[model samples]
Target: MRQIPLALLAPPTHRFDNFLPGANAEALAYLRGLSPGDPPVLLWGPTGSGKTHLLQALAEHWQAGGQRVAWYDADTPLPWELPAHESLLLLDDCQRFDAGQQHAAFALFVASAGQGYNIVATADVPAVDLDLREDLRTRLGWGPSFALEPLGEAEMRAVLRREADRRGLLLGDEVLGYLLTRFERNLKGLMTLLDRLDRFALASKRALTLPLLKAMLADEKIDSDPNL
Candidate 1:
């Protein structure tokens, strides 16, 4: 029998379809219907508000449609030369960009104008609050801006349930309720914890139940392993 690696059983793909838009319905619709001539989009929200997921979804959407797409994070240096034709550019964590990166980003923004290129960027705060240069900040706000709202309790629960279903885990209502009440509230953190629980369940051949979850936490405490 071939053993399946943990890497192969990693988290589900982040797509627009699985996203629970809640109050961001308009923003979701806008991104879904993006075209070549569409204005650049600025997505700002609190941390863990699904900004990165939306950017990834947009990149995937463009890539699937045979469009040239480039995805970049602020931690890395932005390339000076970008394609001049119809291209899709996605930048995440814009709040962390340094002065040099900001200059490069601004140049890219200017080069993309009226060139059939669409840029989508995400930041923890609005353009006015970003730590970038004044010109870059103004350019960031020149396009449509959407503030992604955090998922509410019911929405979070729905997301958890949907993720569990994708992994073929028949999580009981009691288990889901326990997780929501006892674990982290942020979707990303909760999803990480769920991944750990799923691995533990598979290794121990135990069904996902409240008791099993409690046991797994106890084992992590004893082992003192951060990954657990």
Candidate 2:
């Protein structure tokens, strides 16, 4: 059997179509309809709520239309001056920004004000809970803010089923139920584990079953803990 290249096993691209918007329909619509000169948007949600995915999707949409866009993450050093002509700017993990970074962000915001540029940011908590300068916090809330709700169990199962279908794998309800009950419920982690299972199934020419899953977990545990 031919071995699959690691590069070819990259995760699926984040897009608007695949995002399961539960109670965030309004937020999704607002993001999709954004135009030049629209006020900035702040999306607040807990971990695994798809905030980063939504931001990436929005960036993809803008860039696909030939618009200049810049994406900044929490770990990236904040630029003193953002590109003045960029049409869209995305700042992720805003809650992690330090005071100096917040100052730089504020400067960038002011520079883009009234220039038909749009900014979208995400935070782990609501704007009121952010520990930033009062003025900066206030500006972050200048536009409409949306709280992304976590997907429920049914929605997660649906997501898993879709992912399995996309990969041309058959995931039974029993397996999915077991996974949900025994493993992490976050889509990111679940999908990662699913990818591993898919690879194992293909390589071993074995159907995905509870026994296979158990064996895989046992192997993983031994690999991680040699003393086991």
Candidate 3:
């Protein structure tokens, strides 16, 4: 398929490069081969499962390739009736919207398919079970689907390594292991924990050690449980 000339579909947003082991490359490969004929894909995973990252990565990849892609969350109208281009549409958190959006999204899917445009959406549930129009449900099943498995311990470690590298933080294995054992196994939780530790360490001008880490975590627990 010819690359679409990028038009003002949507503005770029922030994206992070902290994919777990074996996941970043796989998701990238999936998007690289995508054509308009590829069915509208629905990525189902719990919050902090890297669904957003994968979708954002795909959007960025397409944008960089000169494809006219529109990316937004469920808060926006379905771009069903927009003029067609070599485009990609990324709709995030569709589950939060009303049923009308689902039906409208189906119409957009039809338009995109006709023009060889790509549509990628994400939700907490599988597309088949999403409260959407029947036709939309059927259309969603026509494409390839992928669910991100919850990160395992080693995967979490890998994620920590990647995130630390991205942020240029010197996170030691001992500190990472300590945080992992005491925290929830979700990316958001891990990031929050790391942010606090980094901030506290910086403010106090102290190296991230076990005692400093414990005090920081203990103080965080007072406001509420930091574990999500």
Candidate 4:
């Protein structure tokens, strides 16, 4: 059997309550306020931003109300028929779509419009700047679009502290600063790294500090190398 890479594993579930809106409160409100007959919505942001989180939250919101949702990504096949009073069509990672995905996404958009279903899409860039087909690009730029901003350092600290509390792990400001300054600034990746570091510390019966973190990373580097 082969082991799956961390990057390939499915991310944890996302919900509205778990999201830290920060400067994206308006965007959050917009998604939550969408109606069945509303025009399509596009959310763009850099990687590790909260675009995926919000999209999943919206899907969760609709699903909780018993509405049907059709979710499509670069790899997944779209549903042929939409069923239910309110249907939500979500297209994720639009910027990375192949030709087939772009075509299918455009068709989904048309069908969603015809059926008065709500459509929401996410991309790394705004539709006007997308590299997809011209028509599809135009269609994507048609509806309300919002740009998500990365969390500020202060906001990130709050999140780290909150999560640390939940995990019963104590992280000092110095250690947290070390992580924030050295890590890739995405909350998902940071959280995963934190989880790994916590486990390493527990197994070693050592305190979690900058030195401990460095040792854990060094150990992981050696473990991942077949020649080592």
lDDT ranking of the models: 2, 1, 4, 3
Estimate the overall C-alpha local distance difference test score of candidate 2.
Answer: 0.84
lDDT scores in order: 0.83, 0.84, 0.69, 0.82
Local lDDT at 189 for model 1:
81
List of clashing residue pairs for candidate 4:
none
**Per-residue alpha-carbon lDDT of candidate 1 for residues 71-127, written as tens digits (9 for 90 to 100):** 767666546568756899887888988888888888888888888888899998999
TM-score of each: 0.87, 0.88, 0.77, 0.85
What is the C-alpha lDDT profile of model 4 across 16-72, one tens digit per residue?
888899989999999888888898899999976799899999999999998888888
Give the residue spans of candidate 3 off by over 4 A.
1-18, 21-28, 77-84, 222-228
Quote the lDDT for 73 in model 4.
Answer: 87
TM-score for candidate 3: 0.77
Candidate 1: worst-modelled 10 consecutive residues by lDDT: 1-10
- True lDDT of residue 80, candidate 1: 57
Clash count in backbone of candidate 3: 0
- The residue-by-residue lDDT of candidate 3 on 70-176, one tens digit each, is 77666776544554567788878777767767767767777766667777888888877877777877776677777766677887787777666665567798888
